[model samples]
Target chain A: MLIYDLFKMALRSLIANTMRTFLTALGMIIGVASVISMISIGEGARQQTLSTISKFGTNIITVKPGRKKTRHVSSDSVQTLLLSDADAIEEHVSLIIGAAAQVYRPAQLKFGNKNTNTTVRGTGRKYAKLANFTLDSGRYFTKEEIISARRVAVIGATVVKNLFPDINPIGQELKVDGNNYLVIGITEAKGALSWYDPDDQIFIPVTTAQKRLFGMSYVQSIDIQADKIEDLEQIKKEIDTFLRIRHGIREGEESDFHVQNSSQWLNSWGDAAKTFTYLLGGIAGISLLVGGIGIMNIMLVSITERTREIGIRIAIGAKKSEIMEQFLIESVLISFIGGGIGIMLGILISRTVSEIGGWETIVSTQSILLAFGFSVAVGIFFGFYPARKAANLNPIDALRYE
Target chain B: MGQLYLNLSSESVMIEVKELSKTYQLGKVDVHAMVDVTFRIDAGEFVAVMGPSGSGKSTLMNLLGCLDLPSSGSYFLEKFDIRSLSPNQLAEVRNKRIGFVFQNFNLLPRASALENVELPLLYGRIQNSHQIARDSLERVGLADRAMHRPNELSGGERQRVAIARAIVNNPAIVLADEPTGNLDTRTGDEIMNVFSSLNDEGATIILVTHERDVASRARRIIQMKDGRMHQDILNEGLIA
Candidate 1:
């Protein structure tokens, strides 16, 4: 028989048992949807992390005090890093444009009747150039302000929203750590870096934060910038070598501090995100496998139920391969339709997640095609056995079947 | 149409079988279904092979229909020796040269009468099947019931639709096994009349049944007893 005729015949049979057909296809629908949505979520998170890393400037390296792998990793216990180390790196490392050290501590702020707890980041004037933090209003604190330990602050967008909703945050006096400081500047919104909201921090002079607020402390982290993008790895190696010598760690002994470049941070994050994506996709893939098994089971039952019809077809001269093709086509049609519906459902779910759940999700065309192609392959792979069974039936026995 | 099945020496013969035997294993013991049965059917002959149940008549029908291969046999459809043909070739012969009408009609319950008739033509690679199916349905006196499924038609009408499907491919033979067994006396007689008319138009038909009355309608009767043929004769004395 012609392929067109075979397709029509298979369609007619599938339509005969509407409920069974629907239930069988539903398995595939759910399987593909979960897979698509899970993959989209993973892709969205990876892209968000990558963009954030880029936004912070890829050439920058962060130096944190102490060996982080040791039990004592908290900055309160690690006092090996200092402002002198930052100055030494800038003087010795020729590739470095700026090596800025910062004292970071979370503190409470009060403005009139309103109050909010946010991070206090204390850094030098070059932090603006090094960290790529652009200003929205007032200028960054100058060198004179750092030397005098002036109690002046730059507020981020989130701090402004929470502490001063209506009034201009810049030029306003805000109490930081129970000490009133003039808010001299407001920075543009940097959005979220994963779970950390970058716009929720208040920037202050490093000397003021160390002497007045977080007293008697070595800086928490050193933020360094390379003169050119190509000099990043070279700068990181120089800082590692210099820090090891300055901290007096011998050869083969672990250094007292870690010098981490931006891309390394991205790579670690990327690895974790990749694992998460695979885990989600794998769980969803199990359900899709179940769906293919469902198709196989239904195809077997359908073939057995339609034995007489097959017999009639065989009697009238349908070849064994033709009978096989018809049943296989029916299964493929089921999965193909299910795959289509799943794609639409996946897209809908992805959009709803980003809109309602506020979760990041991106459905790539590659992922859509993969899910669709997998469903098709599943149908064919599972559909073959039962169809072959149908094709192998003896016409006489089938005709005589009740 | 191009005399593809013809041989000048035996141009009149449509089917020839020799020393045909079939054995089935009923559990462990062998059951001889047919024993050295042999028959020849010329073109345009209306013949019936009559026997009681389990007397090997149905086995003969199955073998003749090419639905089952014999344990040992040389069966020929026109000039093509079926023993030499491949399984695919056998399917082709069944599609293009032979037709079947079952006792239960065996019409696909989901399809219309026209679709049922179009089935053999489809397998035969006949073009313009919709028109041809309609023509075949009209020939079976089912012109108005072309769109009706088998359940919508009466028993005799259903059998007539089966006959239309049987002849739709213009086969060399039409095999009907107990074609009127499911119908009433009147319906059965009507079905037999349709067969007689088809035979009058020079169509070869072989009807299998236990009923002497049904076999009486055929121009020739071949009787079977046990697993062997008892009689092969014309309706020379039975007519009128």
Candidate 2:
């Protein structure tokens, strides 16, 4: 039989029973919709994480003091990194742009009777630039302020809201650890992510924090900025070598400091997001499989119901292959139409999630194609047996089937 | 709509059977549906097969229609040996050479009378099938009811639609099994008349029926009894 005529016959039969056709296709619709929306949500989360991490600057590297090793026994963190180490890396490293040594401690701040406990970080003049911090209103502390050990501070958005509400925080006097300091700047808000809130801290001159507040000379950590992203690895190696020599750690021995870059964070988070996408897709794939089985079940019942019809076709000289082709076309048409509607439904679902649920969702072309292709494959896989059964029916027996 | 060929010459045999036999496995018992049945039918001859129920006339119809293979016998349609043809080749023979009408008027219930008639042509991969199917419906005097579904048609009209479907591809022979079995006497006579006129137009027709009145309409009669041919006679004398 001609393929066009076969398709017309199949379409006519399906149209003859519209309600059953829709019900049979419903399984594929739901399966493909869920797969698309799940993948979209996963991709959205990954993009959001990468963007947030990139906010810390991809070329920036952080070095924190690791546990001190004595006789191969690891102990508590030791303050091996100092101001000289930061300065030496900045001056001696070939690809280095600048470095900032930071000392952080929880301190109580009092502003005219109202008080709030906040973390106070003391660093050099280049700290704000290296950390991607922008001033909201006032200027950052100058180099002169850091060298002279002036009691100047930069307040964050959260601290301003808590202690300096109804008043301009810049140029105001804030008392830190019972010592008075002048607030010179207020940084813009950076939303809280995970366990840390960047907008809840205060920045002060490192000289003042070491000499007057903590009375300690060793710094807690160093943040280094490389000129270009491509130079990050080379810069890290240079810093590692310089820091180890400066701390006098012997060769082939564990360094007392740990070096980390933004790329590492990106790689780990990217891997996690990909795994999450696969997990959701796998679960949705099961639903698609079940949908295919549902199609097979319905097809079996349809063939049984149309046994006389099959007999009539066979009597009229229809080949067994033609009978098989007719039923197969019916099933494939159901799934193909279902997949199309499912793509639209899935896009709508993801859009609604992003709008109402306040979570990012990205619907990619690859996911839509994958879901559509899978649904069609399910149709064929499940449809084959029933079609073959119908084709193999004995014409005389089928004609006599009441 | 075109002139059908008159193969009235005795040398052009349309169907030939020699020692045709068929047995069915009914649990542990073997039932012989047809035993050593032999017959010959020429083209353009109207023949009626008459038998009581369980007399193996239905088995003969099946074998003649190329629907069922014989257990141990030889059957030929035209020049092709029926036993030697593959299932696909047999299907082609059935498509182009033989047409069938059933007792129950087994038209596809969902299709209109027009589509039903178009079925054989569709299977034969014939072009201009719609026009040809309409022409066949006109031949059965059902052209006005072409768009009506089977359920909407009366028993007589539905049988006419089945006849239209049978002749749509213009096959070499038309085999009908109890074509008027489900109709009232008046409607049955009407269906028989339609067959008589088609046979007059040089279309070969073979009918199976138990009714003597129906058998009288044919020019030849073959009677079966208990899986064997009891008698074969020319009904022209009775018509005279």
DockQ, all models: 0.68, 0.73
Clashing pairs in 2: none
- Model 1 chain A: worst 10 consecutive residues (lDDT sum): A68-77
Error of 1 at B75 (Å): 0.7
Q: For model 1, state the Cα shift of residue A386 in Å.
A: 1.9
Best by lDDT: 2
Best model number under DockQ? 2
Residue-level lDDT for B90 in candidate 1:
84
Give the range where candidate 1 chain B is weakest over 10 consecutive residues by summed lDDT: B1-10
- What are the fnat scores of the candidates, in the order listed? 0.62, 0.76
Clash pairs (backbone) in predicted model 1: none
